[model samples]
Target: MQDQPLDASDFELIEDTLLKYGDDHSVLNASELDGYFTALVSSPVQVDIAEWFPAIWGGQNPDWQSPDEGKQFIELSVRHINALATQLAMHAQAFKPRFEQTEHHAQPLTLAEEWCFGYLRGVAVGNWPELPTPLAAQLQAIAFCAEQDNFEPPADLDVAQHRQQIEAIEAAAHALHDHWVAQR
Candidate 1:
């Protein structure tokens, strides 16, 4: 499948399967899974699939109805993971985080809460070492976006600035990846 590009249908299938079979602790959807894979690919040290795959299902394997179903999920996830690594390595400028928009206080808000949350989860699984202050600051943008309960405008900032923070997640991801690449 290396020659074949993953399409929207592949993501839809992954999201549908996760929703259908995943427990409450599973990553919420395809966007989040993409974020998770991004973090894994960008890690300074490699994380084994055996160590990280179970975390995708909330620390256990999903109760897939059939072995074929389980195999398909694995295949799709691996393909996506490889795609993320290749993109980060060779086409960083074109990288985009899969964010979603929703109505917040009757205004359209682009949110990356789920995606950032999944990324943090991957960071935890990767057991990333403490970063220097500058790099840590880049990661702070992602952490800020991941706050589910406090997704509102920061008390110190206006709506536009808050939206900008959300928008900065993609740049933050690229910076983080580049930092790790430089370290390697």
Candidate 2:
């Protein structure tokens, strides 16, 4: 049987725990973690958990109040990662990125920056090699979101434009996963 998927409560617990223990450098929320796992799952090569787990804490493991707490966190993380992999492989186009939405300049915008940053971090862990032109274009779509420092939205930036960019991120993720699946 397929492993049980994480529920809303599980995500709430994750969010709570992250807020309680995560530092400035650590992944601040479940959405970012989801993006991180998405990239890890879509990577051309398998990235070992040993190498990637600590990355969630920005290269240091979190100090849990109890061992059981840590166990629960690890279990949930593994389940999430597995679920993302399965979704990407079996329902590539149906995959939707876990992005947080917030208002910027009084206009609603999808905050993909954190998610994209997590994805880029995962890509770094995988030490991704040069890609073909087509795949590069897809990855570029994601990278554009991550380049927060270089991006400055104009005063007239429409919410539709932001939505379109977020949609491209989803498509890129699905395409990247499909490419790796075909390769493997």
C-alpha lDDT score of every prediction, in listed order? 0.83, 0.83
Off by over 4 Å in 2: 103-108, 149-155
Mind giving the per-residue lDDT tens digits that candidate 2 earns over 1-184?
2345688899999899888889988888887888899989988889998999998888999878999999989899888898888878776655678888766698667778778888888888878888899999999988888888335567787778788888888888888877876776
Task: Give model 1's TM-score versus the native structure.
Answer: 0.89
- Candidate 2, lDDT over the whole model: 0.83
Q: Write the per-residue lDDT of candidate 1 for residues 104-151, one digit (tens) a residue.
A: 667776778889988998888888899899889888888877877336
**lDDT at 60 for candidate 2?**
92
Q: Which ten residues in a row have the lowest lDDT in candidate 2?
A: 149-158
Which runs of model 1 end up more than 4 angstroms from their true locations?
Answer: 3-5, 104-108, 149-159
